[model samples]
Target: MGKLVFLSGAGLSAPSGLSTFRDNDGLWEQYDLDIVCNYQTWIKNFNLVHEFYNKRRLELRKVTPNKMHEKIAEISKRFEVINFTQNVDDLLERAGCENVIHLHGKLLELHCTNCNDITKLNLNDDLEFKFENCKKCQSKLIKPSVVFFGEQAPFYTDLYSTFYNLNEDDLVVIIGTSGAVININYLLRFAKSKNILINLEKNKYINEALFSHIIYKSCDECIDELEQIIQEWNS
Candidate 1:
């Protein structure tokens, strides 16, 4: 009957053979961010945009859910859990969590850039989503469902409403993300009575005083500690 909100980020998916932009030699290092990840680039050259996301989608296909995902799935059973993820991967849903709120659009979906008509990725015999011209619109503009650099997340209004509507009794658990999309200051200001932060390493953006509990440990270690805490509370 209680509620818990999990605000997760790229870090949640990193342990599962995924990488974040901040990691050394990570995905961002290999490409021009402005050209592949920006809305302006999509306008000027859709091919570049397609090329980048195709590689990302292929990379996603090779990975599997890790301990972090399994642990979070276990947490889901104990509370009325609402997951807000900045990650595009479906690993959480794959791990048995449901109704995940993807702050960033997903990699496995496609859309008509002109009409906002979204669809699942269209894969060919090679197991890749083909980005051809948009069939739904005569304009023939098609794009990945992801939120480009200059675009507003489609669900910002819903996310903001959830933040403000949090009851004082609700527990908020934030994992992995650096709070880039939603700043740390704003989260601290709008947080319900209790908040927990779990990250593999220290983020310079975090103020230790703001979190009820600040956990800095490896993914496996964090999972173990969290499970133990949950057990104790249940007992």
Candidate 2:
């Protein structure tokens, strides 16, 4: 049997006191989307881009992993779980899940715009309120490693390799994304594996008939139900 591949999104972390990107009165309402999230603004005002993610980094200090995150970690004990998450947060890692992959990138890591060397920022380190400088080299534009509005996801090479090697018996579960940014076809072509979706609502971009199951509920609740099934199957 193949491993269980989980594709998670913002909803997976929302219960842990983080907000999803597109919800009403969410991040878009608080910040200027064009300035904080777009590429045009990054070039015009790199400092603003830095500030935007810097604030988000600080916010992570207040949150903790919730039941769903812990449960997903527990799943790893029973099966090989490749958690492919679009969220920038480290909630899954904090929840003790091994083998978690961030598709969009991670907020806890920074990259030098000039050298492109990645630095894993320490959550406990009291970084000055200003943008941090690169440690390896004297590079100026050290920014969060996240995939921004115009940037292609940097992990596609690894993702493609994983999908190419996916077995037909592998279970693919997509949760929380509304089909906004990621090209669903990119994942679908290689997912000859069994497929399912767990979301607050049906994803408009996906053909409903394609999935083996569709569960409309909070990801936390759906995962609880799925866990029961898995436990029974194992027993």
Candidate 3:
């Protein structure tokens, strides 16, 4: 079986009207990242964090999967594809992609801060929300079931090992992520070690040498090309 892995970042979801964290013109109504995304801020003011993520969830509810998402799903049918996304959005799953690993977390899942108990919840189109309490112990819920800033990323060791041990012929595709994020950079290196790095970027970053093929284009265009490439490869 041909192995194809995709590592996607925020840009993958931009076509669906999701704003990236790097948007400079205050696309998110001037929401401060540190206030809602950092661990210290979450600890100091859980309500603020909750409200922010809740708003994001509401936005997610309204947005549907875009063309790139559908193309990835179609590509998966021809190859043994694994998607590892830094985005919390569930757009990939909505597009019918299987075996997705959310490196950051999922918007539809919530965990208890005190108990680490995770539960999937149905999201509504509302700016404010609350989730059901933990079954074992009643506690407040948090979004993404993921580690925030200043916290160690969960399943890191396993994620690292999996990336490193892929077969030599495995094709690793990096899409939209910046080269600066340590975890993603490490994974890029791992793909390089296996001699397979196919990266797609709209703009150049520092670690340009890691990719075997670098396509500078929007995710929509890159994914369209990827689908054609996969079809040819499978044939």
lDDT of each: 0.76, 0.76, 0.69
lDDT of 2 by residue, 1-235 (tens): 5688888888788778787667645444667777777754675778777777877888889899988788888888779778888888989999998778898888988788788898777779953236556777877777678887887886777767777787767777777777677655566775677777777887668666657778888877776677755554345
**Model 1, which residues run further than 4 Å from truth?**
24-27, 122-127, 231-235
Model 2 score (lDDT): 0.76
lDDT of 3 by residue, 1-235 (tens): 4577777887788778887677754435666777777876676767777777776777777788988889888878766777778888889988999878887777777777778777675654333445556676776544456557876777566567768877756767777676556455566565533222334444445366665566766677666566555555456
What value of lDDT does candidate 3 attain over all alpha carbons? Answer: 0.69
The TM-scores, one per candidate, come to 0.90, 0.88, 0.84
| Regions of candidate 2 where Cα sits further than 4 Å from its true position | 24-27, 127-129, 231-235
Which predicted model would earn the best TM-score? 1
Native-referenced Cα lDDT, model 1: 0.76
Q: Whose TM-score is higher: candidate 1's or candidate 2's?
A: 1
**Candidates sorted on lDDT, descending:** 1, 2, 3
Q: Give the TM-score of candidate 1.
A: 0.90
